[model samples]
Target chain A: MPFEEKFHLRIPGPTPVPLRVQHAMNRPMIGHRSAECSRLVQKCSQRLQSVFGTRENVLIIAGSGTSALEAAVANTVAPGEEAVVVVTGAFGDRFAKIADRFGARVHRLDIPWGEACSPDALKSFLLSRPRVKAVFLTHCETSTGVLNPVRDLAQIVREHSDALVIVDGVSSVGGVPCEMDAWGIDIFVTGSQKALMLPPGLAFVAVGPRARKVIRQAEAPRFYLDLQAYQEQLEKETTPFTPAIAHLFGLEAALDMLDEEGLENVFARHRLMMEMTRAGIRALGLPLLAEDAVASPTVTAVRGTETIDATALQKELRRIGVVVASGQQHLKGKIFRIGHMGYCDPLDVLTLLSATETALHRLGKPVRWGAAVAAAEEVWSRV
Target chain B: MPFEEKFHLRIPGPTPVPLRVQHAMNRPMIGHRSAECSRLVQKCSQRLQSVFGTRENVLIIAGSGTSALEAAVANTVAPGEEAVVVVTGAFGDRFAKIADRFGARVHRLDIPWGEACSPDALKSFLLSRPRVKAVFLTHCETSTGVLNPVRDLAQIVREHSDALVIVDGVSSVGGVPCEMDAWGIDIFVTGSQKALMLPPGLAFVAVGPRARKVIRQAEAPRFYLDLQAYQEQLEKETTPFTPAIAHLFGLEAALDMLDEEGLENVFARHRLMMEMTRAGIRALGLPLLAEDAVASPTVTAVRGTETIDATALQKELRRIGVVVASGQQHLKGKIFRIGHMGYCDPLDVLTLLSATETALHRLGKPVRWGAAVAAAEEVWSRV
Candidate 1:
């Protein structure tokens, strides 16, 4: 039965958009330069600032999370300038690559996959590289389901070096607590997809005063991804180019949903979902890819066993209308992932765990039929 | 009457999205890496090829029109290599600027603002610059409502130089006739906001064999706008990054609408709409910005007289719940544009013309009360 009619999307992003958000996107598109568009953008920016935990307005771009990551590098770090990029997984590697592509002399601090970057190690690296202009790190490495110590890393950068602390908060911002202003993050980049509960298209970059100053003098060959244009238009409460208007409408609705639920409650819900997913995995005799201390609240990665083919398990789950993500990059076929981010709740996690258990048993792996569900239900009931 | 609730958007690129397309965006989002996603992308690619009038697959990027223009330069034109950028209007100048930003030695062929780049002039320039790696030209210069002869110019490049002919069809592809394969064009770039009848956020670039070969060997510093990554993933029927899935859903529906109407019929409708708009402007005693021979079929630019302030006219139109675009760049306040592109019909054109005449009369410009509407209706009746 193709499951095409109604499938439970469990991928990291293009995460499942809520029905309200989808209906919001059904609204008519306003002209990008119209006063209506300006008002909508202004409202969205203010709400995004609240979600980002920042006082400054967030700049929205009509691209993916990667574009926002590139903007962080292209806007602040000039050619031949030094920046420290901490690589924990695929997304971290991507951040460093974008910096390198923009001609920044990058000091790559590579951490093992499924692990978060240590603040002390990053500080040591910054100490060695005294003239670093920026430090790039991922808050939640989506590829490995590990959450880096962004606040500690930002503090280390503040104490050790005069470098801008730029974070790729693509998968963590709305789902987790990221106080950009209180944490002294110079630049925080995220996408509308993951935890924002919208489809992939709009990327938001919240820039602090220090990064804005650097952007004024930064020499990068950029036009479309230029932050200055976005910044200038943002002052007028509009975007420089044509934005993804439908997505912005969806964003407005998604933000309303988030606000109604309350941000703290949203964070707690994500944490609970992650805990339930982890407990369910443990009950099914599956090992998690990330350590409990570093496990992400947005997505959970499960290590694949020899007996259970991760790809086949994913396929089996998809057949029954559950869609989880297979591993990415080097982790392909080594681990499978279940995304509990954006528009997800306890019931969704329970559904995923139940479906996973069925797929495992059907694939001739284990005999724990309802163990995973019971474990997940325990976490839900306690919450 | 705030007009904010129901304003008619008549901009060139962001033409009004149809009801069906907007409703399509309300559908549930599937995982971007799911089998369903592959099937949808594959179907979208095939339909996009038909719309773009190309045999090759069109690469879809989750960005605005400008990003696709940047991809054209960053993918095929290496830094320090010579390329000819034919400038006719604001978008034309933008194309040159993007190439210059990428460190290309740009030989700019600047034409007047409201005039199309002459094929003979481009041929002469290509003859002089025989070693030019690429030539950038705008198919429909939206800023001034001028349509450059892409077909004739591509022929000139073939006969005069081995340079890759790259055309920015951002506002022209789906509205008018652009035979990519037949015209010997190497690369044709467009956006989803225009005649595609979808909202902004998706950009399409159709590359021919020669351009693909050049892209494989080009040495440009890029990551997100990298065509090579997109080309590689096109084989797998997926995008390299998280795409604007909601926009793609809208795009699929928009393409279905275009297919239902038929491409030839779509072109004819655009042409008729343009003729009607021009006739209305003439009857209102306003001169067109572009000459009749070079005028665009998607949008019509009318020169504002002293009595009729372009900004005031646009504002007045908006007050009556009709929104038209004012001129861009240096032409701002000197002219106004009415987009007759996607999702627009004869009735819409008549309404725009009637509203324009009302605005002109109220602004103290001596416009005959129903002359503009009668002229437009005359053309519509004949059609």
Candidate 2:
């Protein structure tokens, strides 16, 4: 009687864990200090390094993406240090808040919620705060469906100061292109739940040479989120504390699945699916939250009409077996987000569009039946 | 070629996740802001409250048990505030470290690693630190396999001072008896792993009225670990940030499984299994880590002979398909841990003891054949 209800995950993150991943998690338990666990740690770390495109150490923590971000801030920013955070959406603001919490003097460069920070804005922000030790940016903000120009911002930070560049690539890594070494990114961190098609519980942090040096000098108060401690233990293929072992099992399977698809093919697939979703939404006469050029290729945010309640529409969609995410804070109720990342294909896009058409019509938004699906079908046919 | 090998988890904290929990985790993702997610949150919170014996509020975070402990410290202790930590083992030291990380003035009442904190010692410590606002203690220290007297410590803290009594019940809650309200415990927290029979990703914090009031007054920079924000969103069955949804699903199933087994029966089974393990170890000429009165029924630490290479013995057992944890930090190479919590039964204890005896003998630690198995069979028959 307690679990009679059934629900499905179509939201952007914590996506339905793949069956293979779930099976991987069902393996017997092992001791954390054993050589076998250390071997796993070594193998998993190598996979993560290859994924992040870095030769430096990769640290895994038992928390969401935000906790990894906190570790980055607490380890890079010393007391009385300063940093520049380019804020375009909720996650960017979150990074800035974390820096502030670590006692760093944060200089925020705020942009519109649905837009990304311009490279020029970041350059000027760094120039104004000449003593800044780090520049924080989000590769793809899930809340507003915006993808920033991370390479350009990193270049700007390099030109203006000796500050390290940190990126929150939570929702973009597996679904989009992010070459950490090529972009000169000092630190790249992500969560397992997003594009990795794994359950939420583990976070990945990829450190570069500069970030490593900064961490050695950082004096921020930290214990559980300590990247240095993790790095040390990882050298022996273990964690400083007992980690979410089942998550590691699931992640190993996820990485295998990603390899089977190939990273490049996965990125291309995600982009094409996003196009299909966008074409479907645009065909229905709904405005996209951000301009097409700056919109993320992982999630499409459709600006709904004022007459329709986005929350109610989401609920109605759920009733019909579709799950979508609503906007946050200022953008709440103004737009509905459809995710096209991790385990998604053209068929998924079509199903969501069809559901959206029905929910819109049910809410009196006056969308034509089959029109959105037709647009999606056209994209799928070409694929 | 990279994943040609397979691994298992026989650790105490990140125990093996059951298939039922894994299936629950495979549920579709839901939007954190959606009403449906709020329902999931509400349901998980209510069930969590029932398990913790609390009626006030329970919050979930996407981290290991350590992250929850750090959050409790960051949310309960302000800068320059004073607190007392009863150190019975490594976990107690971890609490002190977390408190110091947040700039709290900490006073430690240190006890031997394999012993419980004396109620009189805690009272004396509180009497000495009259300005203390919190007293930290561990319900079960997985490191040394010692179970602290939670009720005794809580009573001492309440009687001696107005300090909030926080218990890290990560390894004990479901396996042993934890009467939060009757014991006057202000805060009780546990992780999803261990006796919960779920994967490691979710942690629960159940706060009583007094703990909630302390959180309201306590201020340290927090965002992701902000208990206030979690409580606020949890009131409506929502989370302030994106939670580990799949992990929650797993937790819901695990809790249901626990309920089906019945708490009293589960506790009894665990005790019976522990007794069987101890009897087997004694037959093998192994010394128990803790005194019988304070030993944990969940995990038992066995002291090995000076000539016995505990690490090699652990490896040999693992190679033969049995996994047990080696001691941590200073205790490493001297002690080995055997866990009998969550899904473990009398048969498992016998099998483990048999395998351990063979492994030790192979590693030059002599023991008569069938001695351990015979001892364990006798205990199993008696029970």
Candidate 3:
């Protein structure tokens, strides 16, 4: 009686949690210190470690992925130190702000919102700021659907200095390949909602041995976001604080689904969805926000013409039970994003595109009647 | 096959999340800026106001309840600001550490573990430091199962100085009556995993007008924990940063469950569980951690004889499909805690008592056979 409608999530995150995952959360709450809870934590951590591409400690925090990002900055970059941040979109700039707040001398290598950061530009920035102790980059910027080459940037950082390479993989990890250990990524952070197919409230950070060494030498006063303390307590199979147990239960279930699909297949599926979505958007005569080569496989951002308000179109899509997200801040009016990350399929994309064509028509924007859906259906039929 | 075992949670916090609540998390993922997500933010805020007992702005954070505590200290009592903290158990010590981390000139009013902080002591501390800008206290210390007299403490804080009254109601909110507006509480925080009968990860902090004004005047280098920023963004019905969407979904479900039961009935049910648990412990000649009057209705901490290692007994309970928590840190070998909050019933108490008796017997500790269960049944019959 409480749930009158079964809403299908077509948006980027808070993706439709599978029934099995929901049932996972309904498990009896065990004492956090109990052996059962610890075993779950341990197993969960291992699964996360595999996704983050690290053998080091991967800690789960009771908050959104941003909390994990904040913890990484607080623990790695100390006061009075310098951090070179490659800013591509809202999330990239967020790291700059967080690093600055922690007293880091932040040097921002700013780029256009929809464009990806150039690896050469990053190399130049690293050379200019040799004293920088850290480099922050977003692997996949959710705001504009641009995927930055973190592996290339990591190589640049390694050649330039001993600065730790930290990647905000919030929307990318499960959607694509992330080889943390092989790529020499020191600190990688992500959220549960995006590619993990779980709810928010759980964020993960895997700290490499090099990053752990930096944390030991750093001098920033931290209590709750202290990764070292969290890891120390975690080694004993306990959290320094009480964890969100239900979210973890859901995460375990989400992981089971991922395991069955296989990480490689999951990545390939996302790529397939990405190509289908892009083809559908192109068929509608719309401009893609990012260049195809650097476009993210998780989400696609389409540039809207002057006559159409992306915000209004988003609302129109919602009215028909198809929800799409608009751009953030300065990019709000220029672009509308469609996410096809975790738990999404070709049919879901077709539904979104069909509803989108209808919404654009209602907004008096010119569009070929059924072109978008036709293009999407072509991809779906093949699959 | 994914769900090999079906579990029904009867633990204190992280209680069995209702099916409706679990389903709520399955809502379509939307961009944080989508109209639907904003409506969710607005509706959830209003619902949270009712639970927090204030019309003030409630900010939701992704972390354990401790993260909210850190935010309270980091946001309100800026560096070098004078503050007083009342310590009774594990959570209380965490408050002190959080204050210390932020460079607050801290003053502590300590009550022995498992005991309640006295209003007189708090009053005296306030008198000693008239310049204290805030006073931190916990309404319920789940670690030792002690519930402090918040109304009395609030009255004392009012008479002593203008210091903001910040109460941690993490484990108390729905299980106890917390009149934040009536008591002039400036900042009140609680987690979903406690009496709210939801999972962890999402923590809510209600900031009154007074607290908001204080935030404007305070100076703390905070980005992820900038509650002031959350307040501003929440006006638009969204978080300043990405939120744990699924956890919020689960919480909305939890709020509905509480509303159906009514707060008064929720409190009454908890009280009954406490009485049943306490009577059983008393009948077994086991001592309770806190004084009878100040004992928390959420959890009952029973002092165990030295021969019975609390941790070992707990492990044994888990081996038999029953789980209970041991005291934290120094209290580890001293007491065993039984949680009766959230979804727990009299039958749960009976099972725990029976398990405890069996565990104690195996550990060479003397126990009157079946006495604790008889005592619990008698008390439950009266209820």
Candidate 4:
């Protein structure tokens, strides 16, 4: 059995937190406005700018990832504005819904669930919209395990429309490279739970000068989600509100781990894990939800075949103390997802494959002992 | 010396978490939508309702205390509506500001900084603002350390105005008795950092039937702050957004501790600590910001005199590895606040008082070496 509590967590988010990070978060609480907390906030915020690939300061909000997503919408598009959202999966639909909730006329450029939105498609979508104020894109759609080409889509948005390029990098940042300035991303948002190797609480938003200026000018009804207030407070080396202080402690440790590993190596490791997971699943004759060209390095969705029930497979895996995520929204019970980000390792992936092979065979599928594990081992050795 | 990390934490919020709760939070991460997570959420929320003194479900928000305050305002007051806000201190002013940000015509019922809103004053204020759609009150003003007479004020609101009573119980709920239904408060909110013995991340909002109805009907633009959707998903024993799972683990442990202590005993313990703190401060010939009757049980603010500088005294205490809160906003540097809630014992308070005494003497005040500690001990023995 896996240590520290029981089940092996292989979800897209709320990923495994390292022991160092957990120990860091277990430190005693301190005054939020004290000098020590100020230093912690400033240092953590500074270190995070590198992961986001932005020179601008990242605003840390003590909220869920969706709070950052909603903040992006609430600060930019005012009532009666026109915004374009690329809908590729559940999170994409969420951005569009958030925009619509904020009274903006949202034009969703829907792409196939398992496919990335092409640059040409985004360009044509923007051309038709004519007066789009902002364009929202998901860097990694967790629901379908599709990694949209955000850089290309953002370039198209810049060339075709005078709109703010907002990208939800909730499941992308830290596990992958995000060149916010280079990609012309006006606003980029990410969560702590995915590749940051911390639990879910903090949401980081990197706002470029253009987005900050627009946020300052926009007259939206927001007090807690106000980004401008966060900026003003950051100049004082403190937060606008009481931050998730323990999470910051964990964040400092997580950042140290990421720094020690080096971000480039971290991304490469995630890629290797992804390759391992895909190979093992494919060796079991499983159907992948996303094309290899557009597959997410963080999470891989494996569709259930007619012979195998995804629900039963998930349940069997759970019985063996292996926990992978089931499909979300409309795809529920039809597919399962394997997470390969954050603190996950090759040995952990091998164990998961070994367990999955047992689960499938136990669920009346053809017996294929050692095949899945061997396939993953082959990928690991090749890498 | 205080163990775990270093200094003694005496801030009003981000209170010192118990080691047990910290250990609970340090448990391994798990899939957010798994059956185990759902069970944790249900059990934690169920245990929390008793502390809130409500039969309604206490919605757990993965955000700051400010987020819950804003959620209450956003869910009830529509744009261009009229509301009455009783501004007693910083938090009360924050509620008024949130209403103003949300485009409501807010009539501020300003009270003196160190005083609570009297029922007569509130009745008169409500009578004058007959068309007020909602009335916002702060149950505990953390800045001034004033615990308002919420039960009485809420009664007056029900009698005099057709307004929904929304209370910011951020610093009050877990430390004091909050009879939400009996007090006629339509909405009540608190945070994990205060008397909950957890870090600053989760916000709990207990919504009454009236508030829920109004929230569903209110036309304010919100997605992440929308409480109705939270209720809908909660029927399935899950949160609408990804919750702070580690905090939920901590919450379960904290609630277990609270339950084991028995809530009445917990409240009395906080009361005893308050009496000890106030006695110790008075014994040192220091002035308290709030009067004895309205002084908060969770925190107490000590004002500076002509002979002593509050800032210098605070720095001296910090030199001895003790941490307390400086006054916020206009009161900064004039007063230093001592928190006596959550995971704190009489021994902690005695140490805090003793450290405070040494700091006062070092700051050139005529200090009797054992006077403050003796006074606190007397109170503890009597209680």
In model 1, the clashing pairs are none
Superposing every Cα of model 4 onto the true structure, what RMSD results?
1.5
Model 4: per-residue lDDT, tens digit, A199-238? 9999999999999899989888889999999988998999
Candidate 4, superposed: residue stretches over 4 Å from native = A1-4, B1-5
Which ranges of candidate 3 are over 4 A from the true structure? A1-8, A363-369, A374-383, B1-12, B26-31, B306-316, B354-370, B377-383
Local error of candidate 1 at A26, Å? Answer: 1.8
lDDT of 3 by residue, A1-383 (tens): 13324344666665666778867876756667656789988889888877887788888888778788898899988788889988999899899989988889999999998889888989887887889989999999988999999999899899889999999999998888999999999999998888988777788898998998988776677888888888888899878887878778888988889889999889888988888899888887878899999999998998876666667877787776776777887997778888889988777887778877887887778889889888877876786
**Ten residues in a row with the worst lDDT in model 3 chain B?**
B1-10
Best first by DockQ, ranked:
4, 1, 3, 2
lDDT of 2 by residue, B249-327 (tens): 7778988888898888889998988888888889988899998899898999988777776678778877777678888
For model 1, the DockQ equals 0.77
Ranking by lDDT: 4, 1, 2, 3
Best by lDDT: 4
- What TM-score would you give candidate 3 relative to the actual structure? 0.93
* lDDT of model number 3: 0.82
Judging by TM-score, tell me the better candidate of 3 and 4.
Answer: 4
Q: Give the DockQ-based CAPRI class for model 2.
A: medium
TM-score, model 2 to reference: 0.94
Report the lDDT tens digits of candidate 1 across residue range B227-266.
9889999899999888888888888899889889999999
Instruction: Kindly give the number of clashing pairs for every candidate.
Output: 0, 11, 7, 0
Alpha carbon lDDT at A28, candidate 1 = 76
Worst 10 residues of 2 chain B by lDDT: B1-10
lDDT of 4 by residue, B1-383 (tens): 45535788887887999999999998888778877889998888788888889888888899999999999999999989999999999999999999999999999999989899999999987887788999999999999999999999999999887789999999999899889987888999999999999999999989999888998888888888899988887779999999999999999999999999999999999999999999999999999999999999899999999988888888899888788888888899999988889988889999999999899877778899989899999999987
What's the TM-score, to 2 decimals, of chain B in model 1? 0.98
Against the native chain B, what TM-score does each candidate's chain B reach?
0.98, 0.96, 0.94, 0.98
